[model samples]
Target: QRATNVGYTALRASMSAAEWLTSEKSVEITVATTTLDGEGQGADCALKIHRLKQPAKAQRASLTGYQPYPVRRGRRVADEAPKPDPANPNSWELGEVVAQDGFNTDAAGKATRTYQLPPGPYRALLTTQDRFGKEVTALLPLTVLDPKGKTLPLKVPNLVAAPKWSLEPGEDFVALWGTGYDEGRAFIEIEHRGKLVQAFWTEPGATQQTVRQTVTEAMRGGFTVRTTMVRENRAYLTARQVGVPWSNKQLSVAWEHFVSKLEPGQKETWTAVVTGPDAKKAVTEMVAALYDKSLDAYLPHYWTGGFGVFRYDSSSLTSQFENVVKQLRHLHGNWFTDYRDAHMVYRSFPEEIMANLWGYQYFGGYPDGKAHGLLPGMAGPPGKDGAAGPRGDKGEVHDMEARVGGERSSMRAMEAPAATAATVAPVTPAQTPDLSQVSARKNLNETAFFFPHLVSDAEGKVKLEFTMPEALTQWKFLGFAHDRDLRAGLLTGDVVTAKDLMVQPNPPRFLREGDVLEFTVKVTNQSATAQKGTVRLT
Candidate 1:
């Protein structure tokens, strides 16, 4: 049984080998046989054989993968990748393939695909291959948009003439004026360098706009004016550089009632007011130049200096040398007096003379025999000394002298009298009220109010009544309203709550023993008539 099993295994092995060989296009086999005689010597025979060649198997090619390039509407998209051609492996022709709904390939074995679709979400079914030549299908998401659809036209506000070149720190105001669309909102922003320093907004339906801002330290070096017009969720921006002025006293010109529109050849007179001390000075100078004959206010003239002599002339050298020597001599003389006082007046007033003049006296100075004696008539006879007056009484010392580590003595000579029973009164203790029963007043100093959503009635009016906080201050209120028709309105005002007399106190939050605190109070008088009052703090 084991021998039979071995024979079956060997047969299976031979069959497998034959099957493998037949699978190829061609196969070959060899056979050998030998016959032996009694003498142990025989002839050997060998046969060589060959199988007929089978037809070659057909090869099929498939797409590997593709790369996508950036796509835009109305623009050609060129995407290329390794080609998927088995038959034409050596082909180098590059081509672009357009698919109705599928991918394409080029002649150079590189896949080039182009997509032209409208604005929508789409999935592209791409056929590709893995490293093992296995086909792989990819699902790619695509979004397209129309290049011209839903395009909004930009409308910018036309700004007025530039503001003043320079402004005083706190006294000058920058006025910005412009014309804008009747609809939407307009914002004016002042920027120093590239940073926004201040901004102002204008309400809708205002065709003409004006805003004024005070010049501040942030606007010192220079600033730019940026205007933005917002409508339908879109903003259009425009900017202009108003150069920084080098002078603080620059003149300002303001035009009134300037005509914005006129027909061809039409004339409209506009009045411009020029202000500042510089403007007045300029006017004065102009008047003086026109009317004053002695004034040398003439236009400048240009002149060129030259030495007219031939370059090779011998005399030219001599003249040039002479000129150089003269210039050097003049320079040497100027150097001595450039920053030095060389005038005769300065020499005449020497240090000794100046000192003597500073201490000079017109009346009697020295004795008659001295080197510089007094003037003969200016001297007068010395009067005899007056008799001594009587002496005054000395002041008595009130403060006592301090002594270290000694018993202090009372300064008073007499002791205070003891209080009698009839003059003494019983002391009463302070009574504190129960905090639970005594309700505390609620603090009503509200600083802000927010009413985000307010609805109007049928009459297109909303009335709201709220108690004002107990804050004696000026309150600024800003509000806006919009209807379903897209119309809007804005409101701004200030309300002041005051009394004839007001008092504010500032006290220390906490105190420690031996600490001296300085308390202060403020008093205000807001009445029409003069008020006299006293402020006392305990």
Candidate 2:
């Protein structure tokens, strides 16, 4: 039995060694040596070694791209590796190499290289060899911008005039006029709350251009006017309209009948209707002007008289004024008495307009002569009558009538109600919800998957089986492998496991028995074909 056991153990050991030699993914190297003893007897010594399996051939280079930084003209800018083409993510486009450098990695296998490149688009290509003698390449794209960066030469509009700062949406017209530079066409852009709301292009010229835009609800919060001089489809100059609060409000004026032509010594009555939420409380003003051909300007009708403007309080919504054309001649001589074209302008403002006026005066006026201030308050409709109050005491009412009749009244003492003991109910403390069973549905927050000792099969492939965590997210995988010979390689990738049709319920963390909640659930369909399903909540 002992002999048999020894033979069985030896045979099993030999079989295991043979399987290792044939099944293992490695190469065997053997060295044999012959030695001679003093007595001339020959002996043989054998050594066996294993080498790393042959590395796979270099199929294609793996490129790691980087985001390109904006390069400014006249400045030295560094380049980055080229990014993959959007059309073909596996390939990269080649470009001219304006700069180049060589670097050596440190103990951490990391290196940095700097290059000064000129302003233009560029691509950086890097090639490296792996431990297996396989060559891989990394590509990155680079871009250099002009020295101005996002800023262009500022070319302000010679004039940005609107008929009124406050306007009615869809009912009022806003006229904007601007002067453009000689080199390009004026591109007008209207932005409201940092968003472009309207934009248009003007005729190419170094002349004044005008556009009439109807106000819309989108412009109620005010807007900014930006003018850019575009030459050859490139913006060379740009500016924003400043010193004005271009907003809509609740105070406006409309002419009932405008009197544009007035003869000498003729008295004409001009009437305007004030309309808006605060029309009844707004202040209206009018100014008459006569155009002078010699000065090429319009002179105020009453330039030599009081204030040169008519003021009215439109408490009833209508403002009217009568002016005698001859009075202008009497005050300022024949220059105003000439047969010139006349014009009338009317404007209305809420109570807050005084504050804006004060600010304008305090700041000595703006360079653009446009007033800037807070929006005028919008007065709502008159409130409805409140409910009637309880009837007054009889004696108090009688005394009020006696006083109205001019008769002396006698004071009467009123009886007070009897006091009664108050009854109170005992208060009960709120009971905490039973949470012992609330945790029945276990929460799996541990999303990490680490297989430190994974063994690949003979074909150099690994199969992993696991139950994914209940979290909806992306998982990144990093793996490295090394053979007995110390030849190593690394790889990284991402995996996402999700249902084509999924229903995710977003419930509150905790809840009471009778609590009302707006339970919401997100349904996502990621399959190529559209599908419909019903959902029921228990």
Candidate 3:
């Protein structure tokens, strides 16, 4: 007997485990009792096992938080109308009844996948096979809505910048840099000449614009690789690629970017550390691989540094400057990413607390920063209870992370959702937790792909520069050695490269009857690609 209060997954008749436990098998049982029976005797127990009879049907799960899921059907045709012969991207062509899902045939030669439907008001039917080759048919219900409304529409996101992909001369390596190569609910797909190149997403909702894909020898010139981005839950879009030679200058070996403009007196030094030989983290491995000596870290992506909203003005700082800030902040002062800023400005606007909870430091005053022991400009962690009501601060946005060894990942990030109570067996694997792992900056690499010997200098050396409008070059204010050259070490240049980069289509952009939306792609290699040694196009 089991306690009724305990929760359990429902037992299903079709369960494979049922055949074993319910068969005439031997089962061992041991019971301990202090009570005796009839005529002054000891406790006794029986080793009894019973077969669980199969039920005629399985139980359905109760729906508690199920919301109105979006619905879609085959393009709806009015009673007086006739379905147009499929012509362009939006028109649902007479799908290959067998391969309509776009999924492939399994080993058993059967295609299967559930296709999405546009929200409401139509009816249709389809026959398809599950991956296991089991044939099945499903029905749809008809509801009334505007018959002329849009059907299932897909959109391609705008490319934030030109993608730069180049080959490591004489090596089978290619380094690509660009924006928006994330994965999950809202993900992006890289396609080359109307073909899928690769797909990536770090997490849901992070439309970041930096990714590197290792390619095989199968890659070649004359192919345009464009990023197709779409928000699975929302609608937002863009795509771009410029100057990719289809006939000549197919000779890119390395690619990178450097912001050419700097403020009056702000200085910076990039510190890079190759990942320790004994790194035990996946993030470390993946990030480190981006700078593999054989590959180039000259990525096509730029950090959205130099962008920030004014804390006091409460107004937007939406200029090229703001965009720069967003990129720089994303890199933080981390050794893992090739964060190069030639024109850094020194502003007295650090957060009062570090971005992490409990990280607080006092700076420039009677600064005995209390409560988490932080000063006025430390970052006090993000997503901190929205800093509402009493005892709150503005999301602690001003933290300083010196680039020494590794990137400091946010502790507050989206995680996999919890499973709700259910009777139906899960048809998919539960996602693994995406937790942040700490890393030291010195054990990572920032420019192995472009210049392996750039950081080959001696150790323990440091440098600092505090310039004024008059070009103040005094190191005493910051204190540092004289032999270090911060300029030669950073990844900076006026030009970058984009190989096999193309523009994806925008299908849902105000579609009317018989309209076509064109997606474009272009490729080019900047002069910077020539100075490097290794170059890979794959």
Candidate 4:
């Protein structure tokens, strides 16, 4: 029984070795093309299989002394490699097999085949099963170029986006319209982080589209919008970053204070009107805001002066105000960001306040001369092509803004108005005086300075005596009559002052990066009597 078992095991081993030997068929496969062109005469591919060795004695043989093996040919494209389908295990989801040809072997056991295929890149595979049911595959890669070499690559499109309402405010709803030229289908994607926030597709021939998205504070961290144009198998991409939104509610407060200081009639009446520079349609939209009753008039220096003054009454005032806010919301994009900054400059340049007092003064009009309108360097509306200016003109829409005020003439300057409000001056530490010495007979006290009465002799010469209150550091002397305008020097030193002021920085040393420097400015009370006043730091 043991001898019989050993003989059976040897027989089983022999059978296994025979199966392995039969499966190891020595076949050499090589692929070639009849013509270099993507398209061929009859087909694009010619594959030759040379059977150098055949299976052992038990395999079937033909009388012609040739081996005919079953062979199958197919292709798998790069893009379709990831697709999966359980129904077709042998044919996993793949790009269509572009070509196939009859497989026939010659008398010398050489099989040659041909395949018809179009121009493109593909992975060609020749698969065959050995006598023992073992699979054998031969792979060949092919990249077919255009036969005529006339096909060209797709190019990136020229793209642009602009707001429908250029002056819209930060919180308002605004639509961004985009226009460009591309050959095929286009895609617009607004992305934040690695994920897509907004996406839209355009048809093959459509070059214009609009995207409406809220201008929000959260987007301040920077989100990007991208547009892609796809043609054939290629893609072109472009991206634009969203800008920070302006939030200036304080502008209303500053504007209110400015109107309050004007003369009674002037406060209610429009002093000047500005218009033109039609190239910038959005600038005209700002005219809607000028109707607010709180504002006197809109007179930008860059614009011509013949514009009609507008004032909103109780009936349309609220609507007009809302329109102004709405327009500002539309202007929340990058194009209008500089304009917002210009508004901030208007405040401080005025009294070292916050407004561009200089610009306002320039637009305010000539105090001595008649009001004359100024035209911008460029004339007429922008071109129909949505250009900011006529062809060949390097004109920027922003240049159409009012020029700096108070710069019309070298002589005109910003001047402090005469003391009309009767406000007391502040006191500085340099000239703090004794309050007990002040006389109450003249209404002079620790907090108030009193002016003394003066009498003119027969010669029209006058002599006066008054007490300078405590904290009085400096004073200006001026001569003025009831109706005549007074002209005086502007510089503090040039004007008549009671004392010489000295300004000194503490430590008397250069400031380092994080150092906080303190300043001590001193002024003497040059008057014979003590005076009450305060010092102003800038």
Candidate 5:
């Protein structure tokens, strides 16, 4: 690039050195003039040109991905990954400072040079040339919140917490929490100045419970002391757990019949019935789940039998599995996809015929056929010497007389049933009318204070002055089913898909990016009556 005009006389030009100066490159954004239609109404349009900087648009990918690539930056185009700029931090972003055709008059009285400002809040004096000719200084704030919303106070302990402690924003001084306060739940109201703000001590959707209240939005930046004294009449401890008994029944009947007609043939057909008054409801729930906003995306990659992630062996075996194989045969041109987790239920079950009537292992003679799991008749917890139980009276010689056949089998002596019968064990028969009740109870381990997300300190002590009507069984979960949020497909990561079946019109999408992340909390009940008749559907 050459300068067009140098303001020097022709006589002095010969005296001037070959190069008087090397012009420093400085970016400037000047508004352009555009005539409005035929009206000759001119409007201002600006072009910003500067040394090409890093990419302005940033994006993130989830853990589950078809192909994973980090985001960066570039001069000509946006790179995959762009780190937060400590110097010109995205602490705040006010959109891109776009560049286009632009012009400006230079120092020697001649128009030259393009213009661009590193994407901006349009704050003045960002780009500056140092002696080294490099980007010298950039001061910018991070753009944390995207889209329009009130600035929510920073949550307690942060959003990535095990037990997310958050505050709800509302008018007035109310500062409300979305976590537990007491066992059942409790809330406190503080009179801030002359305004009423609630200090609630409860978690919403906690065990399917929602307690809403108004609270103080701001605090005095100091700790407020609180004290409460209470007395109660009781002995041991009483923690009430209300569990509804609901049956989920999936019934299938399949039979093979040989025809006596001219052509001797075999025929097999199956009828599956999901029964009970709640069957359709359950079907609706599952069908809804297939396409449910939280889960629809990941149904295809689901692993059956309660496992995480997709194993290559499963992908291989799924093709030959009875369900996939039979579906291919039965449906002919159309085939069922093995991705649905329920295919584990719909597929051909383990057949006892695989074992002969004598119950012999069928694959013992087959090469490369490894028998899986435990044998049908294996007993006593895999490997233990102990038998079922002991015999009360066994070969005893009492008073020096060995009486043969002295004992007779009683009616309760019959063989135990091969199948298990469900039994209900009550913690307490009933709360006693008469029990020692006292005030200022010093008790630890309150059920109301339990939080799965929060662990109580082993050294901490809590006081409760209450008596129990009966012995209470302490509970700490082990091998328990995962909460429904994960199992029901609310966690629709990269591999989730809606192809299995859909609960139409319900689409679950995870925020690929943004603020104010939210998820649904589904509270299922056996029937409307199960939850005080507040439940609209079973």
Candidate 6:
């Protein structure tokens, strides 16, 4: 059977999620003030706020079998993806705070209201606010204690803030993290030697936010950082202190011996120019890396003529690079080598070799945008006679040597050997290693293509600005368009329309004898042209 042709067109736009009112049934919030478990003086105040989880409705696509033609429309696949909303049709967000005052807490985690009034019937309002300016309000009865017997306790807001190092390898920046309830915005203050050096405000909407700063040796002894969350009239505060050390101190302890063994010429080639006696030792080892024929290593060192640039703690960055090497060894069935030997692992271009074999020239482009194909005559490990030997299971030679332009021919020659007429046992699926996880963790391999826009300005000064894609969308032009026209879209802006299809069985999991079970298929089209296709099951 053939599929039918159905074409459609639609425009797509992304808008922020709508906010829900707090008093709706879809939103549940409980605010209570309590005292510490003590008979008299030890009694403390605390506030507990609880929110109940609400179920959401999922939009599923209808599945149809043996369609006649393909459907075409103009939209991205992501736009076609189903966006299920909450089961409650009117529900959205419930974090808008109306009014809040007089919140106090003691060391024992007890909470109380700020105002002091006579012990009698009274009403108190508790409010919760979210980053989207959505708020919910609850009214409860409050009783004031008699002044003659005991004084009423005060209320205190609970805010949390801390400091941590960034994840990027060899980075000298530290990020300050903060979170709190009803925090609309946050202000951060940094101090060194009791002098204010930095102050800034964090973005709203997120309960958590981080601000980063470069730390230097001058602020080594004591660098203090603090964040204050401001929600309406209430202010909550938290602070932390850290010590800064020279960035070069992060180099691995094994670097000195590693560089000393290299030939003087090799040392000069891989070495990064470094100052300070303590740092010189670390630079030698840090600068050791595979030479990229291209000048863009993603770091300053590409221009400085060394292995790598930028100061970093060895464990933070080197550990990740080492993990990649280990993964390569496992993939190639060369796991017998000692992990302790750095040269034995890093010097071997396993990633490049794999790319060459797969004909993936653009994959994992080096910083210099040059593809350093497989090394000449380098195949597997050394055999007894010093010739290349097989490294993979079932006598498979993992290495395939190729020159710059003869990748495909070289691969064929390596795979088809004349020496062995006997067939080797096939490797079963169970014997194969999963490279998915290895590929995911190897971000270093994608450094070049990931930051394609790293360019120098008119002043000849390089600018390392990383522009992350804000939204993932696809676009198509109906008429002819040149490169300049596409670039012009950056200013004039262009709209996108796309669609995709998904199929699922009703009652997703289990099926019962009497229960109705149905198959559903959803087709999303995002093209200007009509299409004809087939959809068949089994």
Root-mean-square deviation (CA) per prediction: 50.8, 43.3, 34.4, 39.9, 37.5, 31.8
**Taking the tens digit of each residue's C-alpha lDDT, what string does model 3 give over 78-99?**
3442332122112222222221
**Poorly placed runs, candidate 4 (over 4 Å):** 1-156, 164-182, 192-195, 216-222, 230-236, 244-538
Clashing pairs in 1: 64-129, 83-109, 83-110
lDDT of candidate 3?
Answer: 0.26
lDDT of 4 at 375: 32
By lDDT, who's the top model here? 2
Candidate 5 weakest ten by summed lDDT: 11-20
Name the better of 5 and 6 by lDDT.
6
TM per candidate: 0.19, 0.19, 0.15, 0.19, 0.14, 0.18
C-alpha lDDT of candidate 5 relative to the true structure: 0.24
Clashes in predicted model 6? 48
* Model 1 CA deviation exceeding 4 Å by range: 1-448, 508-510, 516-518, 532-538
**What is the per-residue lDDT of model 4 for residues 138-199, given as tens digits with 9 covering 90 to 100?**
55543322222222111113333343222223543333322222333557676655567678
Locate the minimum summed-lDDT window of 10 residues in model 3.
11-20
Q: lDDT score, residue 408, model 2?
A: 22
Candidate ordering by lDDT (highest first): 2, 1, 6, 4, 3, 5
Question: Stretches of candidate 6 above 4 Å error?
Answer: 1-183, 204-208, 230-235, 246-538
Q: Give the higher-TM-score candidate: 1 or 3.
A: 1
